[model samples]
Target: MEFRHLGRSGLIISEIAYGNWLTHGSQVEQETATACIRAALDAGITTFDTADVYAETRAETVLGQGLKGERRAGLELLTKVYFPAGPGRNDRGLSRKHIMESIDGSLRRLQTDYIDLYQAHRYDHSTPLEETMDAFADVVRSGKALYIGVSEWTAEQIRAAHALARELHIPLVSNQPQYSALWRVIEAEVVPASEELGLGQVVWSPIAQGVLTGKYLPGARLPASTRARDDKGGAASVARWLRNDVLERVQQLKPLAAEAGLSLAQLAVAWVLQNSNVSAAIIGASRPEQVTENVKAAGVKLDAGLLKRMDEILTPVAMFDPAITAEASPQTRP
Candidate 1:
């Protein structure tokens, strides 16, 4: 696997990171999740990503058990906060109480004394940015977390946080965003802003949650066991991309993928890595073979002509608005 420094930081991580978002401890059986993680390790992946709110808090525990025997010093493990983890009114957001409690909970569940990177899953509009950064600065000072990052944060939020992180003498190294050939929301503003702030992107869903794999045919019924068929939230999340126009356009890219000697999934993952500011692309897997198939994109480079053709085919249906990064409606937590 090829490694890249996360932003301007001295940390080097695998270009293809193994992530367990919807799969571990929820979608698949424990055995299947463990096998997928083992396959990633066999392929030389040194980075793993998870979040505290995934599966209502079971994903992290499953990941910890999966990595029980591995050499912890050889891996870069990451997790996130800022979402509700319980029914209590103070169970969520980036408040000092939440951050302090959440880090301890994560350490216990993840079976690790320290987290390589701890991210704010989303911007907390209810709290001051300084309060959140201050809590994170304490995390770093205590050596519970090595670096800080934010996900789906707008350019303005990133700039503000970066300034605070610098003042606090903490390392804010990366941003995790949903970036792919079809979803270029970060390109117009976030990329440029991150470049200026020395933050590299560790992108998620490079295949658009399986939409870019050409498996969901435009006119066909949703494939059984596929993400689109999942009744538990995953289907609802990807419903917008299930449109016939988007599916048809995705199908047109299959021949181009063949010409480049790649699976449609591999082509999609490699396309995201083409950007110099993207340090890694996080890929989720349900089966071991899926992990093996995606690792092929690690060092592959797509030619300029192919990339141009891909844009020409997909631009009509692409979502590139900078507003896509805006904060969501505040949740009514307990």
Candidate 2:
């Protein structure tokens, strides 16, 4: 796989980075997780993304155990913070206290001297942006983190942080937002902002959490291992995702995927790579075969005509209402 600069940070990461979302420490057992990471490395995926809050903070330990020897140097390791890891009020957010304390915990769990990319998993509106920015600036300067990023933030908020980083002489490298054939909301604001600011867009959920993989077709039984099955959300969110119309659109991508000598997952992943704004796509796979399939997606590129056809099939909605924020989608239903 080719490499790209994570924003302007000078850190090189593989275009198809492996992410351990629900796989490591949640859905898959430790031995299985180890096998999956090795498979991704064998496929030239040098970047491995995980988070402190993923699997209630056990995922990092699984990754640490997997890449203990020569494998450690072969990767750009990433993990995130700013999610609730404990019941205490200070257990979350991007506060200085939390950022400082959390990195040590993450380092211990990830078994790394320093994280390649330390990101805020979500924006903390309650925390002062400057306080958060200053804390992150310290994370890099002190060598605890190589680079810093934020997830699910809007262009305006990104700009605010960027300016603060500039003022403080700190470099914020990238943003990890969800982008896929079915999710182009980032195209509305975040993409343009990131491009203009020289921040690379290392996107997550390029397949819409397996929706674009065409695995959940209309009338098909929900797969036992799919995110829908593992969803940690309200019933409303789950029910909306299971809608027939949504599944029909996902099913439409099957033949298109076959024509490309790929699975729908690959086609969906490749589609994200079609945009230069996308620095990389974080692909999380439950099994080694899924990693293999996703790795091949780097070789598949959709042409303009095919892209148009895809647009027609998925009917991509611009999710970022300038009136709304890039991090939060407009409410879909009551």
Candidate 3:
């Protein structure tokens, strides 16, 4: 596995990160999750990503158990905040109280003393960015987390946070965004903003949530036990990309992958890694073999011609609107 420095930070992470978003704690059995984690380790994946809100907080526990006996120093463990982890009014957002409490809970559940990277899952329009950044700075000073990041944040939000992060002497090193051949929403503004700020991207769903893998064919039956069938929520997330036209277009890439000697999945994953600013691509799996297959994208460079052809094939259906990254307006309290 090839490694890259996260942004300008000194921390080096595997190019293929093992992520348990919809798999652990909800979709897969614990044993399956453990085996997948083991498979990732066997494939030389040292970076792991999860979130406090995933599976209502059970994902972290499952990941902690999966990583049991692994040397902590050798792994780059990451998790997120800014989602509702509980029912109480104080249980969510990037508020200082919630951030302070959530860090301890995540640390406890993750079975780790320090999080390699702690990210804001989404921009908290309700909370002052300063309060959030201050809380993150505190997390760094307290040694509960080593670095800070934000996922799905707009370029404007990122710039504002980076300003504060610099003022506070906190290292905001990475941005975790849903980036793939089908989803190019981050490329226009977020990538340039992050590049200017020295932040690298740890992209998720490089396969467009299996759409780019060509498993969900146009007008075909939804395969049993696939992500679209097993994860209604995830299926909904990928539903837009599941249109007949998109699926038919995706099928055209099979020959390209064949020419490159890569599976459709590997092509999708490698496509994201081709971006110089992308530090890693997070891949989720329910089985160990899936992990093994996807990680092969690591350190594999696609030919320039093949990449150009891929763009020609996917550009018409690709969503590159910068507006997709716009932050939602602040929700008013009643």
**Top-scoring candidate (TM-score):** 1
lDDT of 1 at 179: 93
User: Relative to the unseen true structure, what is the C-alpha lDDT of residue 120 in candidate 3, on a scale of 0 to 100?
Assistant: 91
Instruction: Return the candidate ranking by TM-score, descending.
Output: 1, 3, 2
**What's the best-to-worst order under lDDT?**
1, 3, 2
What clash pairs does model 2 have? 7-200
Off by over 4 Å in 2: 231-239, 316-334
Q: Summarize candidate 3's per-residue lDDT along 1-334 as a digit string, tens digits.
A: 9999999899999999999999899988689999999999999999999999999999999999999999999999999997889999989888999999999999999999999999998888788999999999999999999999999888999999999999999999999999999999999999999999999999999999899989998888888887787554487787787789899999999999999889999999999999999999999998899999999999998989999999999999999998877633235311
Query: What is the C-alpha lDDT profile of model 2 across 1-334, one tens digit per residue?
Result: 8787787667788999988887788788799999898898899999989999888899999998988884566688999988877778788888888888999999999888999888988777778889998999888899888788888888888889899989988778899987877767778788889888888888888877767777777887887755676555222334555778878877877787778788888888999998887779999877888898788988566878888888887774323354344435222200
Q: What 10-residue stretch in candidate 2 is worst by lDDT?
A: 325-334
Candidate 2 backbone clash number: 1
Task: At residue 92, give the lDDT of candidate 3.
Answer: 84
Q: After superposition, how far is residue 334 of candidate 2 from its true place, in Å?
A: 22
TM-score of 3: 0.97
Clashes of each: 1, 1, 0
Return model 1's CA RMSD, one decimal.
1.2
Best candidate (score: lDDT): 1
Give the CA lDDT, 0 to 100, for residue 222 in model 1.
Answer: 91
